[model samples]
Target: MGSMDRGLRALVGIGLIAWGVTAQNWWGAIGIIPLFTAAIGWCPAYLPFGLSSCKTPK
Candidate 1:
């Protein structure tokens, strides 16, 4: 993933986790999906659709 995508995911994941913690809901754990993908620089959901947020290097 591109830097922008990673940053966005990080922001969203953190928000979800924080919301979950304060709200005492386990659903916040779902944020792990985006966090994981950002950390690994890859998203499984993108694979099936052949979608990539990263720009190709010239």
Candidate 2:
């Protein structure tokens, strides 16, 4: 993913995890998906929709 996209994903993931941790809810664990995507620079959900922020290699 692009820098901005990665940053946003990281932020959101952290936010979700924090919220989940604080609330002690399973929903917070869902943040792992975005965190993994941010770390890997790939979003599986975006694949089905044909969406991407990463730049193509020349």
Candidate 3:
């Protein structure tokens, strides 16, 4: 996960949590957890697949 991706994930997580709390839907909040993880540049789900977008030094 690149810096940009991490940043986006953080934003999405926050949005989902906000929506879930305000809308009274725990599911939404729960869904945001994954996004939050991705945003932080770490994805549990991607581990099995060996997926990573983080830029490497040229």
Best candidate (score: TM-score): 1
The candidate with the higher TM-score, 1 or 3, is 1
Per-prediction TM-score, please? Answer: 0.90, 0.82, 0.71
Task: Please give, for residues 18-56, the per-residue lDDT of candidate 3 as tens digits.
Answer: 888889988666757757677556888779999887888
lDDT of 1 by residue, 10-48 (tens): 889888988999999999999888888788888888889
Residue 50 in model 1: lDDT? 92
Off by over 4 Å in 1: none
Q: Is candidate 1 or candidate 2 better by TM-score?
A: 1
- Compared with the true structure, all predictions reach lDDT values of 0.89, 0.91, 0.76
Candidate 2 segments exceeding 4 Å error:
55-58
Q: What alpha-carbon RMSD in Å does predicted model 1 have with respect to the real structure?
A: 1.0
Compare candidates 1 and 3 on lDDT and give the better one: 1
Worst window of 10 by summed lDDT in candidate 1: 34-43
**For residues 1-58, could you state the per-residue lDDT of candidate 2 as single tens digits?**
7999999989999999999999999999989888889999888888889988977889
In candidate 3, which residue ranges exceed 4 Å CA deviation? 35-40
Instruction: Please name the candidate that would achieve the greatest lDDT relative to the true structure.
Output: 2
Alpha-carbon deviation at 37 in model 2, angstroms: 0.1
